[model samples]
Target: MEVLQMEVLQMMTPIEFWRAGFVFWTRAAEAQLEFASRWICAVGLSQRAAQTAAQKATIEALRAASVVPLAPNAISTPVPKRAARKAPRLAASRCRPTAH
Candidate 1:
């Protein structure tokens, strides 16, 4: 490119050379601005995702500590009868049968 630019340089007047340099730098600045805008957008998306995850985790942790289960059935079903829990049982007899 330098070799081609040297050939073009010989044909261009001093004023034309300055104008070409100005145009090249202007295009470079525009390209840099576009890249920066895209990078900032990507960073913003990831930041929002992290914030959403953090909020969900905090809410779940609070619910676990309080042991609250507020659902649609919270008002009617559990009001009269509380939710049943599974109780452990002990073996009363051996596995083999001794008599009929």
Candidate 2:
């Protein structure tokens, strides 16, 4: 295959070579455009699907919330107060150094 391609490349005229390169590049450009368009379309579709899913989830959450009953004072529970901290006191005799 390599020998055959080398022979064909040797036989090709300068114009033919240029033409082949041009055709290959053009095809590549078209393929890239097609891939980009498909990728963009996929992204758009995914975004729309996510939005729809989020909306459905929100609606379901709202329905569930409505079905659940709230207890009285549930919204106004009193927070417990914390007692103030005090420093520990050592007796004078305890604080004094013991005799050696």
Candidate 3:
């Protein structure tokens, strides 16, 4: 079982590993947000204040997990527009008319 698990892990690409890390930290951040919300609400904080506090706590957790929040003007390059998708070509047999 351990060898199987190791083999599976070894098969994971770098992007897959990064995605796994991202999902793990995203959940952790969400849990932090919930905790902050409950704590602030228990303290009789205003709704807006509670939200702000929760957001800050979530950001801190994300930062600790190495997920850096980017500013609006932090992007160095303009994002390129996605190219239009092309329809798949039909197989010759499928395209041909069948005899009745």
Choose the strongest candidate by TM-score: 3
**Lowest-sum lDDT 10-residue window in model 1:** 58-67
Model 2's alpha-carbon lDDT is 0.60
Candidate 1: what lDDT? 0.57
Error of 1 at 66 (Å): 64
Report the C-alpha displacement of residue 69, candidate 2, in angstroms.
72
Alpha carbon lDDT of residue 73, candidate 2?
39
Candidate 2: stretches off by over 4 Å: 45-100
Residue-level error in angstroms, candidate 2, position 86: 84
| Tens digit per residue, CA lDDT, model 3, 6-88 | 99889999899888889999998998898889999999999899999898777767767876676533344587789999999
Q: What is the lDDT of every predicted structure here? A: 0.57, 0.60, 0.84
lDDT of 2 at 89: 90
Candidate 3 local lDDT, residue 88:
96
Provide C-alpha RMSD values for all models, in order. Answer: 23.0, 23.0, 15.9
